[model samples]
Target: MRLGYELKEAAKISWVAINSNRLRAALTTLGIVIGVATVSLMGSAIAGLTQTFEDSLSLLGTDVLFVQKFNWATGGGDWREMRNRRDITLRDAKRLERELSMAQAVSVEAQSNGLVSYEERSASSAAIVGANENTAMVRGFLLADGRYFSEADVDGLRPVCILGSSLAENLFPRFSPLGERIKIRGKKYEVIGVLEKLGGFLFGDVDNQVMVPITRFVSDFAYNPDVNISVKAVNTELLDDTRIEVRGIMRKIRRLGPGDKDDFAVNQQDMLMDAFMQTGGTIAAGGLLITGLSLLVGGIGIMNIMFVSVIERTKEIGLRKALGAKRRTILIQFLLEASFICLFGGLLGLGIAYPITLLMQQVFPATLAWPVVLTALLVSIFTGVISGYLPAFRASKLNPVDALRQD
Candidate 1:
């Protein structure tokens, strides 16, 4: 009960002290405000990027592996070797399909860019995907409307196409895109399917493309273009085995001898995820260092102001000690005062961060979660304790007679 009374008196004194010099307290906490705001905003940005990347991973297909001529994670030094490497071809995809027993599906995909036009509306430089019937299965593309082009469509080199959601909206805004004929590279093809919306990925927008049969793509666009093969595993459990099988078969298809190095690369969603994690870690480390410096500066400012406050309140400390105040009570009063200042600054910082987080949400998935808020507040209190300790301790240990003699 005595401890509670001391705490109450201490809090009352702290509040009055802060209220007496509102402008000074606000100015003193400016550093903390900036520091906390920057930390919160940076954290939200990293979280947003992580969430966006993870969401896009589903579209990349978890159970699938991509066979390509070059590694997706290759550095600049390896570019020359990759450039000289032979292009992954249709024959390699066919061989994989024929030999790989663990694969559920194999797809040959080629890509180019061209104008897609419907009546007067046209989207320029839209992505053009040359894909087989199994491409949808391997790449995890789902039809939003109508149906995917059949194997017959691929075999006959039929002028049938699938529109991405964004492209369909741009071309046929008012009605369904099904059965509507659109021209690709000046050749007319009927729209057989419209794909569900898939936002931006590492390469570019997935929902701004048109998919046609690989055979048709070869005939319409460049002849015998280099292609990437996508192989979907029979099950996720069989993925590693499937990858090994694919590598061995690809090596055989290329006719590499026992001592020859495998020229091909097998890529997966995990590779992209690993690259993103590394990038995120680097960014987080840098951001933490910058924010830590800001907090350190803020803490120093708080400590400086606290020392000044202790000197200014010397007479008051003497009077309180003379009136039977305990050493702990004096310490608690100054500590509470510093805490209130930082707590106010933390709240203000969050207010500033909230709107910025909202602006970031427009581009990604940034959010000010409760855990972040709680952490910021806890950090504020912790800073207060650290900054106020020296001054509070000195105030607690003052000689009443000596303090009273100070003018």
Candidate 2:
């Protein structure tokens, strides 16, 4: 009961001290405000990056694997090695479809960039995708209107095409694009469907592209082209087994000897995700280091101010100690003052960060989640306790006679 009463009395004293030096308290809290804001912003950036990457992964099917000449995660330095790799062809895709029992679907894909025009409206630098019938099943494309090209359309080399949502809106703003003829590289194609908006991925907009039959794309665009094969597993649980099966069958199809290293690469969404996670981790580590420095500077400022506060209150501390006030009471008083200052600063920093977070979301993904808020507040309190400890200890240990004699 006495301890509780003493704690209440200490808190009251701490509040009075802070209220009496409002300007000094505010100035002292500047470091903590900056530190907490920095930490919150960094956390939001990392979280946003992670969310964006994961969303991109969803578009690239988790249960699917890509067979290509070059690995998606490979750096520029490995381009030379990737260049020598044998091109994955339509024939290889067919063979995989025939041989792979574990695969739910297999699709061939090729890409090019061209100008897509409808009347006077045109989207330049538009991605042109050559996809087989199984592409929809493999890539998880959802149609916003009309229908995806059928197997018959692919086999017949039909000039039917699907417009991505963004492209469709740009090309046919007033009316539907279904059955409308559009030119690709001057070759006419009827718009058969519109893909739902899938946002951006890597360097390009996901919804700023068009899909056409691979047969037409190959004949119209190039004489001979390297293609990518997408193989979807029956389920996510069997993805690993499917990948192993695909690698073995691809090696057999390529006529690679048992001792020979596989020339082509089998890529999965996880490969890109893992690479991104490593990069994100590096970025986060660097960001944390910078934030740590800021917090450290703030902590130091708090410590300095706390020491000053302790010295200024020496006579009061001595009077309390001389009148049967416990050392714990003096310690609690200073610590509470520091903690309240930081907690208030942390709340103020969060208020500053909220608008910045909203602005950041315009250019990139950023969210001030609960965990970040909780962490910032906890960090503030922890910084306060640590910074105030030495000063509080000093005040608690002051000799009453010497403290009272101070000018």
Candidate 3:
């Protein structure tokens, strides 16, 4: 028989065999169905989580750097020793600003929690952030209405505030927040601007905060407290050079000698990204462990069903061999049977997983991707081939006389 004719015949025969024992075929496919669904759903969830994190990262801006007293990673560190390190102060920020020319904008930040109130409206838990005038450039926050505080505003200790979008909505839902007065810690401050909505809180949401000048914050809150400095580079391409210069300047400002180990950390977006990657790797590893076991069980089920199939069709195998069928043709036919079973199972699994992925999106950010579908399909086929090999080989090697006499 020609190759195409043989393949067509094999498919028709497999289909008829599956239909003849539909209950058995369906039961055999359960393992594959569960395995594919678990793996594809895990993959889709991780993809969505990564994208959500990236969106949050975008608001921080890759070109900006944060200079602080503590390293984000804090690897192999003694907590007491870290606590003993001097706090990063406003004076350090000033010194760095005076010395570092590569920096486009350098601003110091401090924050406190307080109730934000406007007349009858109030948000009890709100971050009252204290930062310098160039916050817009450094933090990458855009204005929804009005304008950010100016250089003169910081120097003058003006009682002006910028509301984060969510905070604005809470405090002034019916009217515009611009030119409105809100009380923070019993002090009335004029609202100058409201920030555009930022992505969800992976690193604390900016949308639930209020921004004010660092000078006003210190006067009203605490003086000489630890503060974080944000430095924006003049050009993103020269960010590394800018970081190097700023690091040296910060060390000098902190009075750390060349021989002495630095007390403070110079942080960038990539450091946080590394942390995210580590988290992603850990989740993936756990998912793979669970999914692998499920798939292994499924493969064994497929192998067991294939062996049973070969035994049940002993007479059929003998008849095919007696009618001048080659061993290769017999092998191909049985292999195709196993492959089609897995392929169908994979498709059914995808159908089950699609709605699950959609439901997951409603609770968290997640979606099924085409690549994940393709991977499940390929994995199923590969699994079928591996599992069916022994059974197909035994079927092909059976002698016509022995197989015919078995029944």
| TM values, all candidates | 0.93, 0.94, 0.93
Poorest stretch of ten by lDDT in candidate 2: 197-206
lDDT string for model 2 (1-407, tens) is 98799778888988999999999999989999999999999998888878888888878978888898888773623778889877778788788889999988889989898989888888888899899999987888899999988999999999999998989999999999999999888889999999988785453465888899999999999656789999989999999998899999999999999999878888988888877878879989899789968977988899999999889889988898899877888889989999989998888888888899999999988988889889999999999999999999999999999988876
Error of 1 at 273 (Å): 1.5
Residue pairs clashing, model 2: none
lDDT by residue for model 3 (93-179), tens = 888888989988988899788888999889898998998888887888889999999999999999999999999998988899899
lDDT of 1: 0.87
- 1 against 2, candidate with superior TM-score: 2
Misplaced by over 4 Å in model 1 are: 1-5, 73-77, 200-204
- Cα lDDT tens digits, model 1, 1-407, are 98899889899999999999998899889988987888788778767767777888867877899898878663522767877998888777788889988889999999999899998999999999999989987887888999997999999999999999999999998999899899998999999899997775444467899999999999999687889999999888888999999999999999999998778888888887887778778988798678868877887899999999899989999999999988999999999999988888889988999999999888767878777778877887789889998999999999999999998
Badly placed stretches (over 4 Å) of model 2 are: 72-79, 200-204
Q: How many backbone clashes are present in model 1?
A: 0
How large an RMSD does model 1 have? 2.1
RMSD of candidate 3 to true structure, Å: 2.1
